[model samples]
Target: MAPQIVGLAFGHFALRMNPILLLGALTGAQTVTAAMAAIQERSGSPVAVLGYTPAYPIANILLTTWGTIVVAVIAS
Candidate 1:
């Protein structure tokens, strides 16, 4: 999931930099992704690079919400 999100993020980067405002948004989101992955690992449910199933959906939602809010604030 991290890889997928990172891939899509790069694709977004390739497409355009619409409404470019403050810097640090990309790095911030990456940090959020790392936090999510770390939480999953702490729970003993890691989603590795090769293949695995994610076990903590709720925690992921929280991390994602955190990321979204950060992005939104930056975008605004």
Candidate 2:
């Protein structure tokens, strides 16, 4: 719902309002913010942490994929 509202905002008045383009715009912004968070985390630098929770779900899925097999094998 929120992303759609944002997408529409980007679509209707901001540039040429295409749903696909708007979605891409949102996705790109999220990605950059996420990478910025990771860099800050790695360098032990302070980051606007609360502002970046959107990327946590994406990071969790990635970690689960990479570690599930290893974790299962170890548990056995």
Q: Which candidate is the best by TM-score?
A: 2
Task: Give the per-residue lDDT of model 1 (tens digit) for 38-76.
Answer: 445654544331121222344467788999999999999
The C-alpha local distance difference test score for the whole of candidate 2 amounts to: 0.54
Candidate 1: where is the Cα deviation over 4 Å?
1-55
**Overall lDDT per candidate, in order of appearance:** 0.45, 0.54
Q: lDDT of model 1 at residue 50?
A: 16
> Alpha carbon lDDT of residue 23, candidate 1?
14
